[model samples]
Target: MEVAEQRSKVVEAYIQAFEDRNAEAVMALYADEATVEDPYGTEPIKGRDAIYAFYQKAMDLNARLSLDGPVRVAGDIAAFPFTVRVTVDGKRQQLEVIDTFRFDRQGKIIEMRAFWGPLNSQEI
Candidate 1:
């Protein structure tokens, strides 16, 4: 597949998998040695297994995530802006985040980095 097509597919997979809370589906889009640095963390999560564990924990926490629009891809990389809703301590909140994904030659995502914005900021 062309790099652009691959990028779109991978980005879609991520959005769909997370919205469905299906960790396995998300992992399928990753390379064997993929790494993820999601928000709320300093160290990156390595490998599909680790990513699966991370998603599982998020699913268990009842996270509700949604994308704002189509992901923008450049070369083998893409950036997806998203809004995630979660309930914590009996309060509902929304988190604004931007996720950047880098794909390997095989079109499998090799690295994903996520940045989060301030909580309940008027800008959001």
Candidate 2:
């Protein structure tokens, strides 16, 4: 398969795993040394363990995800915008964000970044 096609599948699986709240399945999509910079400006979580922890915390929120638009793939990279709705401590929130992934030659994500800020969130 072409690099873009392969990367698209990877992205699809990542999204599905995330929505399913299956941390192991989500971690399977990343390389050992993968880094995730969720929300862009914060320090990136480095390596599989750290990334696993990050996803674990997200899953604990019981957020439901939906695509804001289509996934776009170019070469070994993919980017997609999505929304997450969750209720935490009886407070509902909706997050609108775009996430980008850079895949390694083996098709595992080496880098993932989420683009969102305070203004990107809304109380629901």
The top-ranked prediction according to TM-score is 2
Off by over 4 Å in 1: 119-124
Clashing pairs in 2: none
Worst lDDT window (10 residues) for model 2?
2-11
Model 1 residue 5 lDDT score:
73
lDDT for each residue of candidate 2 in 1-124, tens digit (9 for 90 to 100): 9787888788788779988899999998999988999978889989888788888988998888888887899877899999989998899999999999998988899999999998999999
C-alpha TM-score for every candidate: 0.87, 0.94
Candidate 1 steric clashes: 0
Off by over 4 Å in 2: none
> Least accurate stretch of 10 residues (summed lDDT) in model 1?
115-124
User: Which pairs clash (backbone N, Cα, C closer than 3 Å) in model 1?
Assistant: none
TM-score of 1: 0.87
lDDT of 1: 0.82
